[model samples]
Target: MERKCNNLPFLLLMQTSKVIHNQIKEEMAKNKLGITEFSV
Candidate 1:
């Protein structure tokens, strides 16, 4: 039980990190799309 409790925060942090990375990727993709559209 104690081990599980200790790991909870680590798991949460990993999930949050993944979410942030995904958001950055999405934003970058959107920027690229905008640039492509502008060029065309």
Candidate 2:
């Protein structure tokens, strides 16, 4: 239980980042921009 609690924040952060990343990808696609282009 202690170990799982310690890792919970990291796991949540990863999941949140993934969600944000997918949203960014979708927005970029709608704008007809590739990931490389969008990053710049």
Q: Give the clashing pairs for model 1.
A: none
1-40 in candidate 1: lDDT tens per residue? 3544468888999999999978867876878765456457
Every candidate's lDDT: 0.76, 0.89
Residue-pair clashes per candidate, as listed? 0, 0
Task: Give per-model TM-scores.
Answer: 0.64, 0.72
Find the 10 residues in a row with the least total lDDT in model 2: 1-10
lDDT of model number 2: 0.89
